[model samples]
Target: MEKRRVVITGMGTVNPLGHNTADSWQAVREGVCGIAPITQYDSSAQKVHLAAEVKDWDPTVYIDKREVRHMARYTQFAMASAKEAMADSGLDLSAENLERCAVIVSSGIGGISTTESEQTRCLQRGFDKASPFYIPTSIANMAAGQIAIAFGFKGMCTCPVTACAGGSNAVGDAFRHIRDGYADMALCGGAEAAVTPLSIGGFTSMRALHVGDDPSRASIPFDGERDGFVMGEGAGILLLEEYEHAVARGAKIYAEVVGYGATCDAYHITAPAPGGEGGARAMAQAIQDAGITADQVDYVNAHGTSTPLNDSGETAAIKTVFGDHAYKMAVSSTKSMTGHMLGAAGAVEAIFTALALKDGYLPATINYKTPDPACDLDYVPNEGRSADIHYALSNSLGFGGHNACVLLKKWEG
Candidate 1:
């Protein structure tokens, strides 16, 4: 049987850079850095002093005042983004088959704040005193579940907890569901709100977080002076529909999700494989799945996590997959500005990739001063530029050796 086509009709995001897609994209294009001194809690005692936090957040804007009490921060972010995406798609859910709609929102560490608070309460009082909503709110799958409930999407409601690759996996899974005829429309992405003291302290203990005080230099991916990743919090959602269904509804198409590739290194738990072998396989697989040659890919939203291992390893992976053509293509890490959104990174970067195709622009890796000898590529340093890219890839490499890549093409029609 022939596979169906899948197209992205809408996108939504609530990131440290902005509250919506327009604001976020604008900030990205302008090379704005969102990392700042830790404001979610007092970080004076911790070695890491900075993070990318969503500013002035108010859940009541998108959800009911009373209902907000039951939802975790991650769930709230997911719901807000989903609502924006659904509205942007203009798909009348009442007119469509509810059973054919899917939701696959994901999170790497869902509601760590909720877990911390509830655990504290349990310890201080008693285990029986824990809130009834505690279990429901703290689970990683609750983002997907809550989105499904709010939007009445009853089909294939699930979450991908693949560490940093969770968000990209969510988008890829939704694409498969539509392309394989299991669903006609889907809302998929990832959300994360783990900016609490416990989350920061844990990453700090593992030496996974940047210990810098300067926000601009904290998440400087591909740069020689980079220390580690800065924790970021947000959500990003995409509305995907079968090509025919989207065309029939006259929905505005952003781009075509042509290919998805996922792989595991089977090597290390926290560190990437030597030379990013797993990431190379995923990118090659995505290109092959798209039925395109290596040279056809014009831009890469790299998984440049600012760490020494990831930046150098991912650069090697690109060379492995694309050969000399890797130098010809524009590669950038928006993480330079957005920081690492953990599970939400892939989905948000996917959105940036789609917008790059749609708007003929390439985002930049800001704060890049000294280039690493190991990572020699055109990182679109410092400033964005116009580029009529036809095909783009978004990459996400996570802990536990997970790697995911999604190939997107410009919507010609």
Candidate 2:
């Protein structure tokens, strides 16, 4: 059987940079850094002092107060972004078959804040002091569940908890569902709100977080002085529909979901494989799946997490996959501004890639002063620029050796 074509109709995001897609994209294009001193909790006693937190968020804007009380921060972010995406798509759920719609939102660590708070309450008082909504709100799958419930989507509703790659994996899975004719349309993305003391302390113990207090230099990916990643929290969602189905409804298309590739290094649990061998394979597989040569790809939204291993390794992977063209293509890591959104990073970067294709612009890697010898790509340093990009790739590499890539093409029609 022939596979169906898939196209993205809408996108939404609530991240450290902004609360909506328009604001976030504009901040990205302008190279605004969102990292700053940790404001969610007092970090005076903590070794890691900075993070990229959603600024001045009010859940009541998207969800009712009573309902918001029962939801975790991650779920709230997911629902808020999903609401924007659904509205942007102009998808009349009442007119379509509910069973034909799907939701695949994911999170790496869901409700860690809730768990920490409830655990403290239990220990300080009693186990029975825990809220009845504890189990429902803290699970990683709740984001996908809540989105489906709110939108009345009675289709496949699931979440991918593949660490940092969870969001990209969710988008890829949803794309396959539509392309394989199992679903007609879907909402997919990832969310993460693990900025609690416990989450930050754990990552700090592993030496995975940047210890710098300077907001501008906290997430300087591919820069020589970079030491570690800055934890970020938020959600990003995209509305995808079959091409013919979307055209029939006169929906505005953002980009074509042309290819998806997923791979595992099977080499390590925390660190990436040597030379980013697994990431190279994932990119090669995505290019092959798209039926395009490596040279046709114009831009790459790299998974440059600012860690020594990841940046150098991902650079090697790009060179391996694209050879000399890797130097010519515009490559940048928006993480330089938004920090690392953990599982949500992939989905958010995917949305940025789609916007880049639609708008013919390439975001920059901000605060990049000294380039690493190993990572010598263009990086679109310091400032964004206009480009006639036809194809763009978004990459997400995660712990446990997982790597996922999604390819997007300009929507000419």
Candidate 3:
């Protein structure tokens, strides 16, 4: 059976650098660093005291005060991005084919702030001190559920919880749904707001966070002196529709979703398989699904999290998948500026890839001062480059050995 084609018509993001797509893309292309000292709370005791936090985000501007109070910060971020994406798409749910539109938003850790706050209240006051909205606010699927309710989407509404791969998985699943005729369009992506005390403590306990006091020096992916990933909080959402529907509606198409691949290491809960065998398989599968050779891919947005294992493992995966062509491809890690958004990483990086295709420009991996022998590739080091990208691949690797890859191509029509 011939599969339906899918294309991205609009995108939205709430990141540490900016709140909207244009501003975020501009900041990224300019190599803006979003990390800073933790200002939301007292981080004096935390080993990793800095994080990339979303600034000047007024949720009340998008949602009612009462509604915002009932939702978690992660949910608020997701809704804000989703609203922007829907508006950008110019697809009025009231006029569109509502039954054929769906929502798939994922999160790695949901509502950490709510969970921490309720726990504190329980300890400070009593068990009865917990807010009645605690359960609803803390669940991971509420982001997708609220989006469905907000937009009155009657099609599939689901969330994929594959740690950092959640965003890519959500988008991949949404694409398959449309391809398989389950839906005509989808509001898909991920949100994360886990930069909390418990999150920091957990990651620090595992020694997975960079403790560099200076924000600019942290999250230096592919840098020889890199320590670890800087925790970040934000959301990225994309409005995807079947290609024909998008064209028929005269939507502003950003890119075409051509392929998707996912795999598991089955080796460790937190580490990649030896030589990145799993990641290689995911990349290869995505290439195959796109019906293109590895050499045909113009760029790759890496899962480069600035961690020792990930950088080396991903480097090996690229070699295994692309062979000598890996050296020629324009690969980069936008995490160099946005820090690690965990579940939201894939969505934002996918946006970066789409923007690269749209604008014929590739954002750089900033602060690439030193070279690692293991990670030798054209990382677009420290500066943006103008390139006519034909096919862009975005990868996401996460805990539980999850790996996902999505291929986006320039919209030809």
Candidate 4:
């Protein structure tokens, strides 16, 4: 069987840092901290009050009012990003084969806010008072479904829910689908808006969120003072097209999707394995799949989720995978600025990785005043720097010990 080449033609995101990919990348490169005091919902009673939210976002501009009423915040974000990505790609749906296109968007904890609203209504005003669109709005796969419906796509519509890894897994699966001749193109990524009262309370109760008062210090990944991750919400979508197809249509290629690797720890529910073996294997597999040496990888957009365990574990995993070269490679976590966007983190960071390859700019790990000995890596601390980047890797390690990675190659042509 002949393997087809897959490349990233366009990307879009509505993140805490910015409303679009260009704006988000600018903020990231500038080392701007998007974490702020929660204003979306009252957090006076909450232990963790700071969260990174999609500020100044008006879904009505991107989605119709009547249609937006049925969609959850996550779906709305997905729709906004899908529209941006499609416009960016300029891949004429009318000219190309619609049956060969697919949508594979994902959300980790879909519509938690919607679920809370309906449940509250059911309790206060009886179950009959709950909205009829509750189930459709809150379901995990609805993001992909809605995108398919909106765009008239007739191929492999899917949503892979691997917790926080959902977005990265979605991208990887789309790449494989195109590479394996299942689809010619795919609109794939993840969207999430889980920063609700219930989610914040649940994470606080589990001691999974940081209790810091300062927004700048709330999400300091790789820093010793880091307590836990700060909650975030948004979406990131990518337009992936076959290489020949992209070239044939004169689409601008951001980067080439060269390799992908996914693994499961099968250990604890929320904790990683003993020595970060699973993450290491995922990185190794991605490198092997890319057919490149460890030294060829110049940068890593880490799944460094501000939490102490994740930072140390990811650092260990990097060292294990890259050996001595790991010390030389630049590693950074944009979660330092954007906070942890749960399911959407993977796709957002993957875009950053591709951008890093495109522009040779490694984003900073903000608020790294005090570094831990455990995470003794060149985390590209505090400021963005330019480097010769040929291959960049992005990681998405989730709560259920799911580790997913994708390798991006700088498009030389």
Candidate 5:
């Protein structure tokens, strides 16, 4: 089968460091840490106190009071990002074209804040105190559904829920939809707002969060002293269309979606396979799909979650896939600044990768003072670097042993 070409034309994001795509990218390029002492809720009693929360976000400005009340923070973020992405796409959909545009956004855990609030009402007040909108706000697919409804996109709408890989999977699925002639374009990405009391406590009980209070050192991916990931909340959205269609419409292409690969460890729920064998397979599959050799790949936006296991496993996987070239490639984990946005992580990182390819700049993996020998790679450590990249790979590995990779190539028309 001949492969259908796809290109990214628009991007939007609301991250912990900033509320928009440009601001977030600038903060990441500057190696600024967004993690800080928890300010949304009282964290004095919790074992972990730091997170990269979306600071100064007043959803009321973007969404009305009554409308915001019916949704959770994750949904709010998704809606805002979708609005921006559609606007950026410059797609003036007519009545006929409206049915050809689609939306597919995902989340690892959605409406966690709503769940916490409803449970509090049930336990503290009474069952009757629970709001009627609790169920609509708490479901996982509502993020995608609400976005579709808001924009009146009636095409293929889906939400992939593979833990941290959810975002990348959703984007990849959207690409497939257009490639298969199911839709002309898609507004695809992911959103996450899981930093609630129950979420923090659950992850803390599992020893998945960094106990360090210092924002600079809290979520240091590829660092020897890295304790664990810092929870974060945000959303990322991208507008993707068939390459020829975008070109015909005079859309500004950012990068081409060359390949997508996904695999499951089938070994452990939370722990990755030893030596990152599963991750290596995923990366190899993506390279094969792109019909390109590993040497052609210039950079990798790593899924380095700051967890010791993931950092080491990802490094091993890259070595297996690229061999000697792995040492020369500029790899970085923007999570070092954005924290771990869970389902939204992949989308934001993919945006960074596309921007890197577009601007000839690689963002840094900040706070790399203490290096880990086990995770030895270039890592674009501490400072951004300028490099003309032709091809780039973005990786996303999730809980439940899910691994996904996407390959992007510089646009040349």
Candidate 6:
């Protein structure tokens, strides 16, 4: 018997660019940068002051106000995105086998803000002030656990904690679950809300964050002027179902999950493998699994973090995998607009790839002024371009040398 096929039925995201998927997509398409001066707190002491913080978010919109205090912001973001995804899927819980559904949400830095504040209160205010919910709320798996409990998806609830690659890892893992007959459907993605004082300060100390106040210039991937990534926070979720099941339910298919590849450099904790060798391998394996030539991929949602190393490394990876064809593909980093969404970056980008295939439009790498020669591929600079993408690839390379890639094909049937 052939392996089952997986299709993305619904997607939802709450990100720096927008409060929801629609708004986020529109903002990226318009080449509008979401990075702004940090308003979460006074950053006068921090060297990095800009971030793509989610705005106008009201947790009570999707979660109960009473339960909100117990949940971390990351969990809240996950729940909000999951709520939209579940509703968009149109899956009737009463009619389906609830046991066949699953949830896998990822987070790089789970609830650091919660941990930081609680630790601060415990140290400064008193040891008695530490909230009892600290352990429950600060763990990385709570996003998956809480989302599972909230939606009652019980099959295989888990979290992939692969640093920045967590989101793509969860997505790829979910695809396998549906394909291998372990589950018929899965709610999978990633979330993060680690934009606290500690996270910012830590990244700043490591020189991994952009030290700029200009929103438009903060995340200019592939640009010669690029410095470091602009940190962002949010969640992105997708409802993936077996192809036949989705068709039977008259589900609105956004795209089909054709291939997934995961690899690790075993090289470094913070830096990508010297030349993005692991990333190139993952991209090659994904395309091979898709049974498509490099030229068939019309667009690439690059893991261009705007950092000099990452942008150049990803470009080298593309060239290594695609060779001359790499120059032909329209590649862009939505991170140019949404900033670096940490663990949620890959899932959000996977959604962008699907939407690009479905809508026939590619989001641009905004603020691309001076192009770095090493990163010479077409960055789809400045404005959104129209393209009938049959196959799109999204890349996510994280700390600890984790690399994951997913291929999405336009669904016409």
Of candidates 3 and 2, the better by TM-score: 2
Per-residue accuracy of model 5 over 1-413 as CA lDDT, tens digit each: 55679899999888898888888888877888898989889999999999999999999877778899888899999988888887888877763377888888989999988888889879988988888889889898998999888888998788899999988888878877888788888999999998888999999998889987888889899999998999998999999998888988899999999888899999998999999988899899889988999999999999999999999999999999999999888999999998899999998888889999998999999989897899889998899989999999999999999998989999876
Alpha-carbon shift of residue 193 in model 4 (angstroms): 0.3
User: lDDT for each of the candidates?
Assistant: 0.94, 0.95, 0.92, 0.92, 0.90, 0.91
The better-scoring model by lDDT among 2 and 3 is 2
> Where is model 1 more than 4 Å wrong at Cα?
none
| Cα-lDDT of candidate 4 | 0.92
| Cα deviation of 319, candidate 4, in Å | 0.7
lDDT of 5: 0.90
Q: State the lDDT of candidate 3 residue by residue for 355-380, as single tens digits.
A: 99999999999988989998898999
**lDDT measured at residue 128 in model 3 versus the true structure, 0 to 100:** 91
Model 4: runs farther than 4 Å from truth?
none
> Where does model 6 exceed 4 Å of error?
125-129
Off by more than 4 A, model 5: none
- Tens-digit lDDT track of model 2 for 202-233: 99999999897788888989999999999999
Q: Work out the TM-score per prediction.
A: 0.99, 0.99, 0.99, 0.99, 0.98, 0.98
RMSD of each: 0.7, 0.6, 0.8, 0.8, 1.2, 1.0
Candidate 1: tens digits of C-alpha lDDT, residues 242-355 = 999999989999999999999999999999999999999999999998999999999999999999999999999999999999999999999999999999999999999999
What clash pairs does model 3 have? none
Which window of ten consecutive residues has the lowest lDDT sum in model 4?
A: 89-98
